[model samples]
Each structure stands twice: as structure tokens, then as C-alpha cells.
Target: MRVLVTGAQGQVGYELLQRVPDGFAVFGYGSQDLDISNADQVRAVFKAVKPELVINAAAYTAVDKAESDAERAYAVNSDGVGLLAAAAENLGIPLLHISTDYVFSGDGDKPYTPEDVTHPTGVYGLSKLAGEKQLSEQCSRHLVLRTSWVFGAHGNNFVKTMLRLGSDRDTLSIVADQHGGPTSAGSIAETLWALASVFRRDGRLGWGVYHYSGAPACSWYDFAKEIFTQAADLGLLEKSPNVNAITTAEYPTPAKRPMWSVLDCEKLVDAHGLVPKNWVQELQTVLRQLGERQSV
Candidate 1:
């Protein structure tokens, strides 16, 4: 399979490139190499690559920045996805798209199912929801995998941020009111590949919106505490910082974060025999990788 992945420099994008299985040819492009928001660029890349499968990792992921930069957010998150769908549809191929948990209003208590009513409270979430709609409307064969709280060794994420803060500050304050699973980028990339392999064998997938996040949801405070513990154990941190639990009001941002971002991944498991990985274990792997990178 000739798979073309956008946002190649991103957390998940880098993993997608690195973990290409045998019998598959993967081509990855960063924002500079292939600007997904540009129609001409997207069309030209698709034409040149002649990809049999298209996995769109490109997105405007700056949540707080998207509040003030709605146009750019929609351009990449909404318009860019639509363009990819059009290109992939024209080629008669499957378009695998990544979406976020922010599509919800953050008021719900239980895990969000794929069929839950979407009510995004911020511009970023609104833009991503629009992208999901665009993909469904523009392409016939597509899978919109919605994930939450993505962190990884390859790019900027909560894990790296916490590690940086933990090393510099004696005490770190994290929002405890907000809760969600801290998904690993490598795990997400592998999940996409597993679907790609299935599609290669069967020539089709269950094909729809599905949720795949880390298991056992936790708050930002909880996530930070774990990061410090694992990082210190791995000798990545000199000493664990004192993590303080704080409310959302204590740390304000431009965008409204989901109070509850836990996603129900049963649909994916039932359809594809895929389940979410334990994030605590995944965190250990990430810390080890970060340690290796630091050594180099």
C-alpha cells in the first residue's frame, strides 16, 4: 500500500512514518513540504504520489490559539480535510482521518460514544467537527478516528511539557477538574496502521466515526503526577516535582477545555478487534525514548 501521511513532523505523523510495516510504502510530508490547507498543493501531492491510501495527520491543533485564529483553524481543520477527501474520492481510495474529543461540549459525565450529539464550545472543536462533516459528505470510504489527550516523544505534548516543567520548577500546578485519557502518539499511529492492514486484506473497513483513546481516564494533575514518577524512575528527571492539583479556574486558557474528555472505544473494538492501550505503560516508553534522545 502506498500511504501518504500529512503532518509528518507532528507527534503522530512522525510515528506513522517510523512504524511503517513491511509490504507498505509510506510517504510523509510536513507542513512545509505539503501544506494541506492549500488546494493546489494537496492536489499536486496526491497526483504525484498516486497514493492508494491517504491518512491525514495534518491539523490545526493549537487549542487556545485557534480561539483567536479561527480562519486558519477552519482552513486547515475543515477546508483542508475536505480537500483531502475530494482528492482521495477522486482516486477511489479510503481516507483515514484523525479527529479530537473536543467536538463535545465537555459537560457530559460518562464516556462519549461516537454517536453522541456533538456540541463544541470552542472554535477549535467547532472547526474539527466541521472537518468530520466534510469528510463524511465528500468521501464514501472513510474512517474518522476521534482521539483525546495526545502525547508523544516526537513532538510537543503534555508529557514533554510536564517533564520540562518538572525539571525546572520545584512545584507544578495542573488542572485537576479537567479529565481525559492521555493517549500515546505511537499507539495512535499503530492503530491507524492496523486499520490500513485490515483494509489491505479485506479491501474495506467498518467505515465510520470511531473512538480510540488511552484506557483509564485521569485528570491533568493525575497525568502530571504519573509523568514525574515515571520520569524520575527512568532517571530522566533528577527528582520528582511536587505536583499540585488545581481547578480549571486556577489556570485559565483562551479556549474552554472539556471537563470530561473520556471517549468510549467499544465501537472500534467491536468492529476491528482493537482496544486502547494502558496510558501509564505507554508513558514509560515515551519517557525512555525521551531519555535516549537527551543522551544523544
Candidate 2:
């Protein structure tokens, strides 16, 4: 099977490149290789590859910047996804699109199900929600996987930022009010591979919106503390900082974040028979990789 992975240099795409299963011909492309925002470019790449499956990991991911650059965000997240969905629909291939938990308004304490209403609070979330709507309307065979708090070895993420800050600063303050699962890009990529394998065998294995993330919800403060603790255990940190917990208002950004963006993974678990590892365990593995790379 031929699989095309977009945003190949991003965290999730990078992990996908490393974890591609055997018997599959994978073609990974970064934004420079094929910018999804350009319709012609997207079409040209799809025509050349003619992939059996397409996994779109590209997006305008800068949450705070999106506030000032709404146009670019919509062009990339919404229109770019529309182009891919159209191509996949024309080719009769299944398209797997990655989404985020930010699509919901984050008003409640309970986990959000797939059927929950989406009232995005920021430009980034609104753009992503538009993409999801387009995919549902334009493509029949597509899987939109919604995840949260993604971090991995490749690309800039919370884990790397926390490691850097913890090493440089004597003390750091993080928001404790915002709660969500910290998913590893490696885990999300592996789950996508499992779903793609099923699609390759039979084109009908429950194709729709699904939520998947690390087990056990946590706040940003808890996540940072865990990252520092793991880094110290792996001997990656020179000195750990005193991480203080604060409310979301204290640590403000340009965009408003969901206070409770945790997604329920029951649908994914029931259909794909998959459950992500705990966030702390994933953090340890990432720190271990970082240490190994530094040593080498």
C-alpha cells in the first residue's frame, strides 16, 4: 500500500516516518515539498503519488499567532483540508485527518465525546472546526482523529519548552486551571498506522470522527512538573526549577484556550482496540530519547 503523509517534519509526521509498518510504501512531505494551502501544489503531489491512503498532519498550529493571522490560519487549516478531502474523494481513497481538542468550548469538567457540540473560543480552533466540517461534507470515507496536548522528540512542543525553561530558570509558573491529556505524537502516529492497516484490508472499518489521547487528564502545571521530574531522572536536566501552579488568567496569551479540552477515547478504544500509555510514561520515553541523542 502506498501512503502519503503531509507535514512530514512536524512532530506527529516525524514520528509517523519512524513507525511506518512493513509492506507499506510511505511518501512523507513537508510544507516546502507540498504546501497544502496551495491547491495546485496539493493536486500535483496527489496526482504524482496516487497514494492508496493519505494522512494529513498539516495545519496552522500557532495558537496565539492565529489571533493576528486569521486569514492564513483559515487558508491552511480550512481550505487546505478541503483540497485534500476533494482529492481523496475523487480518488476513492480514505483520508485520515488529524484534529485537536480545541474544537470544543471547554466549558465542562467531563470528558468530551465525539458527538459533543463544537464552539471554538479562538481563531485556531475555529479554523480547525471549519476543516472538520468540510471533510464531513466533502468526503465520504474519512477519519478525523481529535487529540490534545501533543508532544514528541521532533518539532517544538510543550515538553521541549518545559525542559528548556526548567533548565534555565530558577523557578517557573504554569497554569493549573486548564486540563487535558498530554498525548505523545508517537502514540497518535502508531494508532493512525493501525487504522490505516485496517482501511488497507477493508475499506469499511468505522470511518468517522474519533478522539484519542494519553490516559488520565492533567493540567499544564502537572505536565510541566512531570517533564522536569522525568528529565532529572534521565539526567537530561542540569538543574530542576521550582514549578509553581497558577490560574489561567495569570499566564495569558493572545488566544483563549479551552479550560477543559479533555476528549473521551471510548470510541477509539472500542473500534480500534487501542489505549494510549500514561502521559508520564510517554514523557519518560521522550526524555530518554533526548538523553540518548545528546550522548551520541
Candidate 3:
């Protein structure tokens, strides 16, 4: 089966490129190759590839910046997704779209299920929610995977940021009130591969929304401390930074983040018969990769 992957240079997309299983042809496109925001370009690419499946990883993911740039965020996140869905719908192909947990207002301690009401608090979340809605409305065969706190080897993510900051500063303060799992893009990509492989054989697997992330949930402060700990274990940190916990208000941003945005993976687990690894274990593997790269 032929599969098309967008945002090929991104964290998740990069991992997808690396982890595509045997017996499938994967074609990847970065922003320079195919800008999904352009309907004509999207149509052209779909026409040429005529892929059996399309995984859309392209997105405008600047959470704080989206507060001021709502239009661009919507164009890339919502409109781009709509374009891809339209193209796939026209071609009778399944579209697997990536979404976010930021769609929730983040007010409750309980993990948000697929049926939970979405009340995005910022432009980024609003745009992503719009994209999810568009995919659901436009395509009959679509899988909208809503994930959170994605980190991976090949892109700008919290793990990389914390690693850099841990080396640069002796003390760091991260918001403790916010809670969610630190998902690895590699894991998400692998799950997508599994889902896509199944969907290719049986189209029944490519409908409805699913939530996935690392097994356990944690706060941003906790995640940072874990990153430092892992880095120290890998001998990557020269000087360990004292990561302090602070309230969201203490580190105010233009965008309002959800205090509790953890997603319950029960539906995904049941649907795909899959399980996510512990977040700390995934973090350690990532740190090991980073250490290897630095040494190389």
C-alpha cells in the first residue's frame, strides 16, 4: 500500500518516516515540498500520489504565538486539514489526522475521554479543534488522533528545550499546575503505522476520534525534573539545574493553557489493542539518543 505523510520534517513525521513497516511504500512531504494550506497544491499532490492512506502531521504548533496569530494558525491547522480531507474524500482514501488535547479547557482532574466536550482556551487549540471538526465532517474514512505533550528526537520539543536549559542554567522554574503526559512522537508514529497497516487491509479501522499518549500523566515541572534526571543518568548534563515548581499564573503567557489536559487512552487501547510505554522510560530512551548524537 502507498501511504502519504505530511510535515515530514516534524518530530512525529520524522519518526514515521523512520518506522514505516515492511510491505508499504511511504512518501513524505515537508512544508517546502507540499504546503497543505494551498488547496490546489494539496489536490495536485493527492492526484499524483493517489495514495491509499494519508497521515497529516503538518500543523501550526506555536501555542503561545497563536494568541497573536490566530489567522495563520487557522489557515495552517484548520484550513490545511480541510484541504487534505477534501482531497482524500474526492479520491476515496483514508486520512489519518493528528490533533491535540489543548482542545479542552483543562479545568478537571479527570482524564478527558473521546466524548468529552472541547472548550479550547486559546487560538492554537481552537484552530486544532476546527481542523478535527473539518476532518470529521468532510471525510468518511478518517482517524482523528488527539495526542498531547509530544516530544521526539528530530524537532523542537520540551525535552530538547529542557535539556538545553538544564545545561545553560543552574535553576529553572516550570509550571507545576499544568498536568499531562509527555508523549513520545516516536510512539505515536509507530501506533499510526500499526493503525494505518490495519486500515489498509480493512477500512473499518479508519473512522472516529481516538486519544493516545504516554502511559502515565505528569505536570510540566515533574516532566522537567525527569528530563534532568535522565540527562544526568546519561551523563549528558554537566551541571544539574534545580527545577522548581510554580503555578501557571507565575509564568503567564498570552495563551491560556489547560490545567488538566491528560487524555484517557482506553478507547485507543481497545480499538487498536495497543499499549503505551511509561513516559519516563520513553524519556530515557530519547535522552540516550540525544547523548549519542552529541557524542557523534
List TM-score per model, in order. Answer: 0.99, 0.98, 0.98
Backbone-clash count (model 2):
0
lDDT-sorted candidate list, best first: 1, 2, 3
lDDT of each: 0.94, 0.92, 0.90
Q: What global local distance difference test value does model 3 have?
A: 0.90
Off by over 4 Å in 1: none
- Write candidate 3's Cα lDDT for 166-263 as tens digits: 88899999999999988999999988999987876676683898998897898999899888887887899976799788999899899999999899
> Candidate 2 at residue 14, lDDT?
95
Residue pairs with backbone atoms closer than 3 Å in model 3 (clashes): none
- Once fitted onto the true fold, the runs of candidate 2 whose alpha carbons sit more than 4 angstroms away are none
Better by lDDT, candidate 2 or 1: 1
- Model 1 pairs whose backbones collide: none
